[model samples]
Target: MKNLFLLLLFVGYSQAASACDCLMTPVRQHIKSTPYLLKGKVIAVLDDKNKEGRDYHLFLRSIGIQDTVSRGYSVKIIVQQDFKGKYKAGKIIEIHSTYSNCDMLFSAGETYILFLHKAQGNLFPTYCSYSNILDGSPASIDLVQAIRTELKSRD
Candidate 1:
């Protein structure tokens, strides 16, 4: 009986951990599917009192493709109601996620390569999108290059 209980507990924990598992799609696909893609830093993170989520204002640093984006644009992201993370101002991060799979996780003062989607004139990040931290990894570098290539091709 004890062994069976332990096995069940382990299985439950495994399932919970894999709940947010997502398969990484190609960079081109991500760019083509979304309306906007850029690299920016978090200027402020505010609580949406009307809704059960948080809104993030990102300072647009560099855009992948030159569209109608400005230098300082606000990318409003709404996460789960229970989200309690602290996003300080002046933190460099990326925004590239959809709103289907899960909410994107971010930490202050960290740089990331984000893929962004537009809905109702608001940009959002999800866990199912292509994103990477600028941790000096070859994969991260490749992703950035791929985004630049895609943007150039569109032009």
Candidate 2:
């Protein structure tokens, strides 16, 4: 399996893929165990501050690589999202998210035109999180609105 994975990495940049699509699967993904994902066009690199206290290096890159093993070419940069860090404008980031942070913090499996880069910290990062609307849910959800609804009072 490891050799197969390495083979996929050898293939340099691939063709363009889904630019915007967030269809999440109910089946849980082993974020830590799976190799880090870094497939996307580094369109724009900027400084982003997540809900977490710390800051991060996020890139407005595109994503699209569902068939890594079959295609023999994966845009992914590292091994598993846990030990990988996405860079924005070429700079490592530090986040302060309070949610699940590791496993449930970052969204996985989707083509985000732009998303925050996640990493654990090192020569490379180790983060595995993707954003996918809950099944039968809208393509996008206003997290702030969700928070307000949860905090709103009932008559």
The best candidate in terms of lDDT: 1
Tens digits of lDDT, candidate 1, 77-110: 3221111123333334334333222555455444
Q: What is the lDDT of candidate 2?
A: 0.29
Q: Please, what are the lDDT tens digits per residue for candidate 2 over residues 27-121?
A: 12323233332222222222225422122211212123332222111122212222223443333233233222231222334322122333444
How much lDDT does each candidate structure score? 0.48, 0.29
Q: Show model 2 residue runs off by greater than 4 Å.
A: 1-24, 27-129, 132-137, 142-155
Task: Quote the lDDT for 88 in model 1.
Answer: 35
Error of 2 at 90 (Å): 22
